[model samples]
Target: LLWSSGDESRGAEQALFQTVAPFQTQVSEIERSRRMRGKRQNLA
Candidate 1:
């Protein structure tokens, strides 16, 4: 029973990570672009 419950929780964690991973990548991409824009403004 304990092992089964542990497996279930682990599965849930993986599912949550899968759902969140894309959003995290998108957020990082946006931040990178924003930083690049800021650098361009500073240069100008």
Candidate 2:
């Protein structure tokens, strides 16, 4: 019974991660672009 509950929680965690992963990647991509732009401005 405890084992089953643990598995259920794990599955939920994975599902949450799957949903959030894309948004996280998008945020990271935007951050990377912003950093690159800053570097370009600094170089100029």
Which stretch of 10 consecutive residues in model 1 shows the poorest summed lDDT? 1-10
How many clashes in each candidate? Answer: 0, 0
lDDT of each: 1.00, 1.00
lDDT value, candidate 1, whole model? 1.00
TM-score of model 2 (CA atoms): 0.86
- Per-residue CA lDDT of candidate 1, range 1-44, in tens? 99999999999999999999999999999999999999999999
For candidate 2, write residues 1-44 as lDDT tens digits: 99999999999999999999999999999999999999999999
> Candidate 1: deviation at residue 10, Å?
0.3
Identify the runs in model 1 with alpha carbons over 4 angstroms from their true place. none
Q: Model 2, poorest ten-residue lDDT window?
A: 1-10
Tell me the spans in candidate 2 whose CA falls farther than 4 Å from its real position: none
- Could you estimate the TM-score for every candidate? 0.96, 0.86
TM-score of candidate 1 on Cα atoms, chains taken together: 0.96
